[model samples]
Target: MQTQSVQKNNVHKKSRSSLSVYLGQWNAPVVGYVFIAPWLIGFLVLQLWPIIQSFYLSFTEYSLLDAPHWIGSANYENIAKDRLFFNSLKVTFTYVLASVPLKLAAALFIAILLNRSIRGISVYRTLIYLPSLIGGSMAVAVLWRNIFGTDGFINNLVVLFGFTPHNWIGMPETALSTLIILSAWQFGSSMIIFLAGLKQIPSELYEASSVDGAGPVRKFISVTLPMLSPVILFNLIMGIINSFQMFTQAFIVTEGKPYNSTEVYALFLYKKAFGSLEMGYASALAWILLIIIGIMTLLNFIASKYWVFYESESGASK
Candidate 1:
């Protein structure tokens, strides 16, 4: 009887221990969920819901006024057949192709210059970066429009140079170029990233190059380029991605004016959604844009294997 009582006591203790452990395990996840609940809820309602809604709406004819009516792939069909849609694609492709390379080059060049230990370097970097900080704003876009306008600062400078003052944004030939230049001018973020990459490149490599009788140009070609390859690749991909979304500059600066010469794809999508109240069409366009961006990103990654060299790989090979 005493042995039976002892066994019952042991079983009771074991059950309590198991319960405590189960509760402990449950408590941790519950606490974690509690902390994450707000962010999870916000993401689900705001971001995820809109994204899902857009996907669903893409198949339906949705205008803010009426309930969305389901139509199957009609929006995509219309976009493919639209000439203006093609024009927007052309403009956007041109911008992405032109601006990204130029921006990366300019950013890298500026970063190389800034990498030097100079007096008031931080101030200079700040001044240089300030434009990019404000570049996306409506105010900056207005300033850009004014600067490139017929009687604006650029024409004023040209007038001083004794040339006929040309309307930069008024002409088709110069309008897209002006936008490309504006995009390239906002390379401060890229410059900062490049500067950081430059800093990471070991000074020992430079010293070793010098010991091997390498001049500035030779060392730059051999050491600097290879060392900065990964950074260049990173900046190139990001620049391309960002350039594809070119909108505000085109919106405020040109508004796809000069015969739709500057109508970037995103701007066209915006007009379809808001101006024409073709929410379904716009959603379709958005999905197409996402696919295009994904393909481009994939291509970049594939191409990186040929060009992007890592220090780890070098170390491993050696």
Candidate 2:
């Protein structure tokens, strides 16, 4: 009888322990969801709902006034035939391709310079980063227009140098390039990231390379480049995404003028939705942009596996 009683007690203890463990596991997910509930709700309401709605609208003809009429693939078909759509796409592609590499390179160079132990380095860093904060504002865009205007600072400088003055922003040929330069000038945010990445790299690696008779350039190429590849990939992807979505600078400075030479994808979409009252078509354009960015980011992630070396994993294997 005592043996049976002890066996029953052991079974009860095991059941209790199992129940407690199950409750603990359930509590964790509950707590995690509670903490994330606000963001999740906001995302669904603000971001996800709009995206889904836009996808549905992309197949319809809705002018934000009347009921939406189902148009199937008509919008996509029209985009293929539209010359302005092609022009806007060309302009956006040009900006992304031209600006991203130049901006990232400039950022990396400045970051390297700032990473050095120099006097008043914090002041220099702050000054460099200030442009990024101010450059995206409407006021700065107005300032950019003045700086590149026909009778503005650039032309004045050209005249001072004994050259005939030419319209910079007023000309279609130079207008887009001016915006590209403006974008490159605000490389501070990327520079800050690069500086942080540079700091994270172990100094011992450089020392070891130097001990092996590696020069500065050689050390950079062999040691620093490999370690910084992940950060570079991150910056490259983000820069491309941001560059592709550039709108405000061109919108404020050029107003898509000079025969719509500066009408980027975002501006084109805006004009379609607000200026022309074609919200359905604008939704299609937004989806297309999203797809392009998604594909590019995916390609970058796939490519990074070959080059990006994580210290923890790579060093462990070595």
Candidate 3:
């Protein structure tokens, strides 16, 4: 009985020691995780859960009022057959292709100007960036509508310049273009990025080029473009992704009107989900958009190997 009692005590001591050591090993990390538990729970519950649920819903016919019926790939198949889907794709692609380059160009130009050490530069930058700060808001969309409508700012300007007054937003050909211009108008974020990129470039390169009898334009082409390529590539990918998801202005300013010339993909998905109560179809569209965005991002990454230049890599290669 004494031996048995000793054995029991030893076993209990070992178990306690093992548990204490284990707790000691993980104490800091466990506490750290405890502190972050709320964010983790929120991410899992709010963001990840919904994403996974949406993916599953894409495969099923789910109206909020009814049970989710297993429909397999019928939703995806319907997306292919739907005519408005095609129109949405066309309009979205047009907006992306048109807006991105113009926006980048405008941003780069503004960034170059802002990079200069001139008086009231901060105020000018703030004033210029003010449009982007208000961009995509309902107020901005309404203001944009007013600016391009018949008897609006554009028409009034045209009349003042001795040209016939015209409705910029009323015509199908020009409607999408007006939105593209609006997209370009919010070039502030891209401009800030370009400004940062410009600052990263060493002044010595400019000096070296100047010594080699290169003019400002030539220096910009040789020195600026190659160094700034990485920033440009980043901005391009982001712009493409953002442009694909455009909806607000299309909904507010045009409502996909003027012969459906501005029926963007996101607006179509939104209409499917809320407007038509076809949640399953909208989920399918969302999945399709994910695939498209994934493909575009993949393509950009693949193409980046050729165009995106890093100074460290270039220096090492040289």
Candidate 4:
């Protein structure tokens, strides 16, 4: 009886060990997929599905109340003659052209200032980044509206300086400028990215340049700019994309006021999608915007080959 019981126990242990080994083999192959299942499902359901639907709907007339009807390229044809479409595109292009460069410049400048090794620098960075955290909020938009209003804080400051208080948001010429200024002010994200890039730059390069009697301006031009070009390209593309899609501030603060001077493309798309219920037209616009962004990004990549220097490429070439 003892011999039989001991053999039974050994068999049980062997079975358990074999089972565990099989499970380990299976888990090794499937664990990564299990972890990524949520993201994959989300992409398929929330993003890829919507993108496909939008592309299909862009070719059809899909009012919310009725079934989508096939319309071929009529929407695109109509867009060709749509004055507001042109206006919104013009405003968006102008905003992208102006705001992106300004924002990147400001971010780079602040990053350079903040990159020093000093006490409480993190606190300073946090304080500066705070605005960007709340920058897109409705409250911030309202606050910005008040600041640029005729009798708001900015006007008070102008009065103190003996300059006449002007309605910044109410004017066509200056309305977009205020939005651009706000965009530039929310440069904290770009600044952080620039700081990261700056940290990655080899100090040996700077030392070598310094030893060669390079001045501050010379070192920056020779050493800093070349190494930082990739970061600049990244920031530039992101800035262009964000600036082109700017809507909340324009919607809440200016409402594309003073003869639609500040009417950005996204705001126009919003009006078409929700306001007029022209879902098909809006989808077409969205796709067109996507195409425009893709082209711009492609152009940036083409242009980058001329200016963007990679350390790996340099090493490989040498």
Tens digits of per-residue lDDT for model 3, 21-121: 98788869787999999999999999999999999999999889998898999999999999999999999988999999999999999899899898998
Q: In terms of lDDT, which candidate is stronger, 3 or 4? A: 4
lDDT of 4 at 270: 97
Q: Give the Å shift of residue 56 in candidate 1.
A: 0.8
For 1-318, candidate 1 gives per-residue lDDT tens digits of 999999999999999999988878876778799999999999999999999999999999999999999999999999889999999999999999989999988998999999989799999999999999988888988998899888899889999999999889989999999999988899999999999999999999999999999999998998888999999988888888888887889999999998999999999999999999999999999999999999999999999889888999989999
Model 2, residue 293: displacement in angstroms? 0.6
Question: In model 4, what is the error at residue 211, expressed in angstroms?
Answer: 1.4
Q: Report the C-alpha lDDT of model 2 over 252-293, residue by residue, as the tens digit.
A: 999887898899999999999999989899999999999999
**Alpha-carbon runs more than 4 Å astray in model 3:** 1-23, 27-32
Query: Which has the greatest lDDT?
Result: 4
lDDT value for model 2: 0.92
The candidate that wins on TM-score is 4
Q: Return the clash pairs for model 2, or none.
A: none
Alpha-carbon local distance difference test for all models: 0.92, 0.92, 0.93, 0.94
Q: What is the per-residue lDDT of model 4 for residues 1-318, given as tens digits with 9 covering 90 to 100?
A: 999999999999999999989878886548788889999899999999999999988999998999999999999998889999999999999999989999999999999999999999999999988999998889999999998899999999999999998989988979999999999999999999999999999999999999999999998999999999999999999888888889999999999988999999999999999999999999999999999999999999999999999999999999
Error of 4 at 309 (Å): 0.9
Model 3 clash pairs?
Answer: none
